[model samples]
Target: MSESFELADADRLTVGTVGPPGHRVFYLQAGEAGRTITLKVEKQQVAVLSQAIAELLADLRAPEAIAAAGELLEPVDPLWAVGGMQIAYDQDDDRLILVAQELLAEEDADEDDAAVGRLRFTREQAAALVARGEELVEAGRPPCPWCGYPLDPAGHSCPRTNGHRPPTP
Candidate 1:
């Protein structure tokens, strides 16, 4: 069985990416003390997570200033790829909880064997993640005005225009 993690009162929680815009790999990282858990995630996941966190924060009073920016910890190896995630607020503890489940192949028989990670963080950390997530996603290649698909840096064949016109630059 894969290992699972529960990071309570985490000191660090952030989303980051590596590689060029068209071929980037996004990651969600959380750590406390010396143990860090990195999970491979899709760009869409980051975007949605950020939006969700922002919505959750909107219901509460304004958070404090964001913490100082920090680079992704070294050895950015991911324990697993995230298939699904959830976020909730603990009013009593006044903390935001993020849960990520490991992605399992459909052919895998035992769904319960999948690893899971639970990270509890402060509102400031959540705000920082939202800001960083948005920045990283926006830094990627611009989208196609016609089809709303990401335009390739080299070329792109927009479906709206069919194959008649050359790819957008």
Candidate 2:
């Protein structure tokens, strides 16, 4: 009952974001024949996807795929927001396949308005996406020294402080 879309040979495929480093929204975008499809995604999803792609590529018989610098990631209006995400390797085609399900409210779980999409990308394209993901993740708030939690602009309340003033060092 849900809608579906597939981009088998996307001319452009990459993970992108909107807004500043700490307040950004992640998205997965694919383009072909002047048309583009965008799906909302979580930052953690991007990180996982990037690592998954890298690992999958490493296991392939093909040579390692390294992302070239300065690749451009264009923006697109999300056709549908995404919730669950999945990835697979298509050995026959030598492609990385990604699938995303539309974001749904708890009450709407049984509704038929859900959207599902599949995108296939070459090793090169997948590697490029991973590179961008790494950059975006690192651009966020820096981690605290005492604890590994990310430091907010106002600073994190380090548990190691035991309610005392956080160590300056």
Candidate 3:
């Protein structure tokens, strides 16, 4: 059975990437006390998660100023790749809850065998995560103006052009 973590009142929760631009690998990390849990995630996941968190925060009172998040901690090893994720607000505790489920293999017999992680953090942390997520995403390769796909540093063959002309700069 895979290990799961419940980081209630986590001290740190953030998203970070490894490698350069087009070859980047994104990760979702949460830590409490001395324990840190890292999960592999996709670039699109980070972008969508940031948008969702921004919308959620907008519906409630704004959070106070938060300290800028630092770079990813050393030994960034992910326990599992994230498959599905969920976010919700806990009015009673006045905290944001993020739950990430491990990606299961196709041949796995029991769906319940997949590990799950739950992180409860304050609005400040959530806001910081949103900010960092947006920054990381924007730092990557620019998107194609026509097709909305990532434009390769070398060159891109945008489908919108039907290969009749070069990709839009």
Candidate 4:
């Protein structure tokens, strides 16, 4: 049988890693009408992400939620130590946001390991993230990857950077 999860009011959840560990970091955001509360942290993996969400859901309020997420994600992910959190936003309105920390799974105990995990995204959430990406692209922003710098195959120079090599054909 196929399983299903219903994410009610998905605008209340934003998940991702913060930055390098050794510091308190995690990000969470909850939107209302359109805007949301957002949080950022250092390094958090799937397992840690799960716990952080659970805690945030329980808190309901904004600050506590962010604090919990930050605490959980305070440590860097041993494997993919570089990741950050971002919450979707709708420019038409404003809303409350939250942030939190998280922990990883047992299988990912080492700093150089990979683990498979599962997450459920509601239709609205999926669409929102996608739309956000599209908006970025429309704004002359490059799609996500390679140090936040947009990649241009036309040998274009980047005003935000210098002395960079273009992707190899």
Candidate 5:
């Protein structure tokens, strides 16, 4: 039972996390001159969302249409954690749209209990968000270039290495 909101013309859009890699929490947030909204997001969701937004921007067919994306990644007073998210591009307005819905009790399937938030940003903003996402994700644990798996602080077992650790010099 929460109120829904929208940032139709937000000045900033960012995705980032807090804490150490294995103990981090991801978030997505947008804001305007005087309004801001933040929601907890999953790392997988961030990856998917970033790829989707990037592909959508590429479909615009006009590189110049993209504006400079602000690279800031901080949220102010997160409203709530998001349960589900949806995205689409408004062809008529040339805007990318993202919707985040507040998580409700699983047993409560009633539509009336849903609270949805929305964000509409320009293609430039979408591009910027995508870039930010890439930076944020890469900042985490460095992956094993061999098998493409995360390399643990104690070293990882690269399956490609035939169950052997990297040769110790």
Candidate 6:
């Protein structure tokens, strides 16, 4: 377990750990005094988001890539979405802090903007493209436009190339 647990408020989100030996946990603490709707979060969601973070850090450390991974979590439950979450890395303390919030429906614009900026594709558009690609694969036909010139498991040998021979097994 990481040292610190993330924290958040309606106005802002914060991530920080208390220090070593602390276990990561998620909760929906009550607001000020009395609130009709309480905040919500799940430990599983945090685990999922953490995996996304690891993936984002695998190849490159670009801010845009980080933002893209954050975008992928947009449709995820707001309480667990890491968009606004802050990460604090303290080697000496051996702690990591991550903050998040459960945005209200009125805040959809913020979520939309974040996702569009990263993927350059709306949710609907992405879904359609995926569906089309799946159809092509299922039919064992030529690759879709997006895939372009599919390759064999071994090496590629396409007769369509200039003066090329037919593909051989």
Question: Judged by TM-score, which candidate is best?
Answer: 1
RMSD, model 3, all Cα superposed?
Answer: 1.4
Candidate 4 — what's its lDDT?
Answer: 0.34
Report clash pairs, candidate 6.
Answer: 4-17, 16-97
Point out where model 3 deviates above 4 Å. Answer: none
Pairs that clash in candidate 5: 67-124
Misplaced by over 4 Å in model 6 are 1-39, 42-48, 53-84, 107-169
lDDT at 129, model 5: 82
Relative to the true structure, how large is the alpha-carbon lDDT of every model? Answer: 0.89, 0.77, 0.90, 0.34, 0.77, 0.30
lDDT by residue for model 6 over 52-142, one digit each (tens)?
A: 4444334333223111111111212222222343333333533233344333355464543332101122222222322332332233323
- Which residue pairs collide in model 1, if any? none
Q: Point out where model 1 deviates above 4 Å.
A: 167-169
Cα error, candidate 2, residue 117 (Å): 0.7
Is candidate 4 or 6 superior in TM-score?
Answer: 4
For 1-169, candidate 2 gives per-residue lDDT tens digits of 4457988887788777788766788888887777778787888888888888778877877546555423335545678788877889888998888888888888888646778898887888877887888887788778778877777776568888875886453
Whichever of 1 and 4 has more lDDT, that candidate is 1
lDDT of 5 by residue, 53-153 (tens): 87777777655554544443544456777888889988898777899888777797676688899998877778878888877787877777887777777
Q: Among all windows of ten consecutive residues in candidate 3, which has the lowest summed lDDT? A: 65-74
lDDT accuracy of residue 122 in candidate 5:
79
Q: How accurate is candidate 1 locally (lDDT)?
A: 0.89
- Superior by TM-score: candidate 1 or candidate 4: 1
Q: Which stretches of candidate 4 lie over 4 Å from their true place?
A: 1-28, 32-36, 40-121, 141-169
Candidate number that wins on TM-score, 5 or 6? 5
**Sort by TM-score, best first: what order?**
1, 3, 2, 5, 4, 6
